[model samples]
Target: MTPPEHGILGRVAGAVTGKVVDAVPVEEILEHVDLDAVLDQVDVNHLLDRIDVNRFLDRVDLDRLLARADVNALLAGVDLEDLVQRAGIPDVVASTTGDLLGRTLDVARRQVVGLDAVVTGLVDRLLRRRGPAPLGPVLLVGER
Candidate 1:
């Protein structure tokens, strides 16, 4: 992944960290350089403008669909317990269950990254296609 690709991950990591770091010195670091602020400053829509949607979807990880014993058993027409025993709680195929789980999670993460890229592309396309629109309505008025 390139620097721009990291933007999506950075935004997610920052938001997750921010919730727990509000009172820490990290706030000072954020004041100096905030991921969300940086994301806002950039036109993410611009980055997504050129991607092919079909190709993007093809890159998504589908292994997670069978990562669960129940799901795998159902798909393969076997009993869940039998499947579990065959692929034990601590083993999947030949590797440790934890290793299999980790790989599955890695695939899921990559899928998420692919999805984010597609979304960013779609946003860029829409922004470019629509040009600019009037910001006229303030539906819910809030007190300052």
Candidate 2:
């Protein structure tokens, strides 16, 4: 190839090129550029392979990020039952609930049985019927 141009002609050419470059608006230049053709020349996967995710995370300000976060939005996104199960609370809740339910049913059953016997006795006396008009069903008595 020819030797590098020097002297007055090269300096004039360089000055004119610099002026033209300075005059072109970057946005107009970008509009004229073939962006798809430029992107096709890039190696996206190779660029991504060079990133250190752990090191990147280490540099992140998690406390600051959390401070800026919408607590209500985050709560809305969460599954409370899943979170409770993950924290190992479901077994305790289930056992406590089961015990509470058993106690409640026992109290209710006793109340109903007592009320039923009282009503039966009152009806038996009014009709002048036999001893105890049976509390609940007579199914068990006949079976015996």
Candidate 3:
């Protein structure tokens, strides 16, 4: 039978083999490899299709993931004014402003009506009209 491998000789042989293997650089091995052929063999679409999206999402810690993200940096990359304009925010603001102005004008008109009564009373008092003074109609200053 052939000599049985063990002890000091076996250990030395193993060490020498390991050192020789280690001496062979990975870059030298990669240089000999056909990278395009290796890439062609990989089915990326098939691998992705095998992934369960819901299960993957369930495994994800969304809040923790979001906490790690730089929100201010992300926002800095975005044009907020442009985004608001695209979302029709300006139109909404304009419509809301118009509604508010219309309501304010209506309120002013009501207040002016009360002022008309007060001014008419003052005018009647100046004219020295006796008995119950009639609250006259609103007279526009520039109207015919």
Candidate 4:
């Protein structure tokens, strides 16, 4: 027989055989296959690279998925005491307080320096004044 005749015969035989077989028999047949060995032979990175992530994300409902999650139960699994112990809050607070106080003192020093300049300028002008001071007037030193 020709190859076309063989192909037609094969399709007819496959259709007849597929009608007799079901999912349970398919599962039994697959039970004999070593899935772990098959997976080990496959390139996972190549397989993942072929997947359409955007199409997968488009089908996902994030809100509904999150709603199904037990958040309080998840939180309960976390050890808060352990987390706090690991955080070292006292050391952090001390370092932060020291930095804030240092910054504040620097600003205060700048303001004091500015005040000293103003006071020194006033004193120099008063010492250099030549004209007679106005009587009963609120006199700015050295003003004509």
lDDT of 1 at 121: 70
- Please report, in order, the local distance difference test score of every candidate based on alpha carbons: 0.71, 0.85, 0.85, 0.81
Any residue pairs clashing in model 2, and if so which? none
Q: Residue 68 CA error for candidate 4 (Å)?
A: 2.1
Which of the two candidates, 3 or 4, achieves a greater lDDT against the reference? 3
Error of 1 at 143 (Å): 30
Models 1 onward score TM values of 0.25, 0.40, 0.49, 0.43
What shift in Å separates residue 85 of candidate 1 from its native position after superposition? 16
Tell me how far the alpha carbon of residue 74 in candidate 2 is from the true structure, in angstroms, after superposition: 2.8
Question: Where does candidate 2 stray beyond 4 Å?
Answer: 1-19, 82-90, 93-144
Angstrom error of the Cα, residue 36, model 2: value is 3.6
Which model scores highest in TM-score? 3
Q: Which pairs, if any, clash in model 1?
A: 45-124, 48-121
